[model samples]
Target: MQVLPKGVRHIPGFLDRTRQEQLVEAIRLVVAEAPLFVPEMPKTGKPMSVRMTNCGSLGWVTDRDRGYRYQAQHPVTGHPWPAMPDVLLEIWNAVSASNKTPEACLVNFYSEEARMGLHQDRDERDLETAVVSISLGDSCLFRVGGNTRGGQTMSFRLESGDVVVLGGEGRLAFHGVDRIYPNTSTLLKHGGRVNLTLRRVNP
Candidate 1:
């Protein structure tokens, strides 16, 4: 495991595949209640290509007409969002040194061709809080740039069971997955990479 100059952590094989699968199933159950749906972009309310869903106090939503905001219930089910599973919480507390408690888990699924452009995660209420991300399935080229953006960016080839902690100064840094490399792992059920971003929302 190594810490990037930007302060992002790259812990290799942090979660074993078996534990990773269990965590995935637990997260899937929450998603099953809500399922993955594309969020609409704020202001214009355009739908984002990346399907997103959450488990916790609020779920992230976006539509060309609505935009980014956390809602107490699922837009589709009208049911209160589910809690973040135990396995996820264990992992979060373990790595974050028990200093942070996560209330929202945003699961992002990427196919071989799917990719996220450079962006900063500023939707949460507190900048002091940390964002703990777990990666599974195929490997991906994850990139982290300077907080102000438009500078030399560092990238990592993240694979299954990798845990990355984004916090401190890097908490507000611009970052995203460049592209997923296919056939990187046979352990993943189907294909693609699944990123579980666990965050503490309440300030």
Candidate 2:
């Protein structure tokens, strides 16, 4: 088994092609309902490279005025986020090791030139709950490091159908996408990467 940071698990190709296709379709429906919107950096108001949307009861969002927060309505439309897909709930149940279902599913779309800065998912009320992420479409370079900043980090490629779980000691670790490799997979017709992160927002 490939070793990683404590409590961090990477399951490569966890979903088969058929499942990936089904996930893609499910995401399509979610996008149609919620729509992707650009997220801005806290205070700075700098727009993130990737576009984002969400499903489930709460959605993580950031902007110059509000900073990072979870809300029940879409930033753009003011409508509640779409329901969490059953496939995602099943994945979380199988791997999260927690009885509570995730209340937020952040959907991030990265173009060929997009990347994310190293950051921790720390806005949730409960740190005990694990964060589950699923990758689809093109591959990307994922970077992860210790809980503290400027610590030794590692980079690895995350391909389509891969699943990553951040739990226990690794739950607060810093991680992000360095870059996307276009055309690495034929999963998305337009050639981009979609990342789904399921998180429990409240205690």
Best candidate, TM-score-wise? 2
| TM-scores, one per candidate | 0.92, 0.98
Number of residue pairs clashing in candidate 1, backbone atoms closer than 3 angstroms, sequence gap of 3 or more or interchain = 9
Error of 1 at 195 (Å): 0.5
lDDT of 1 by residue, 1-203 (tens): 54474667778999887898798788678878878877766677665556777887776666666666677888777888888788988989887654767878888888888888898888888667878889988999999877877877878899899998887777887889888999898766788788988887778
- Cα-based lDDT for every prediction: 0.81, 0.95
lDDT, residue 39, candidate 2: 99
- What is the C-alpha lDDT profile of model 2 across 40-129, one tens digit per residue? 999999999999999999999999999999999999999999999999999999889999989999999999999999999999998999
RMSD of each: 2.1, 1.2
Report the lDDT of model 2 for residue 115.
95
Candidate 1's C-alpha runs over 4 A off are: 1-3
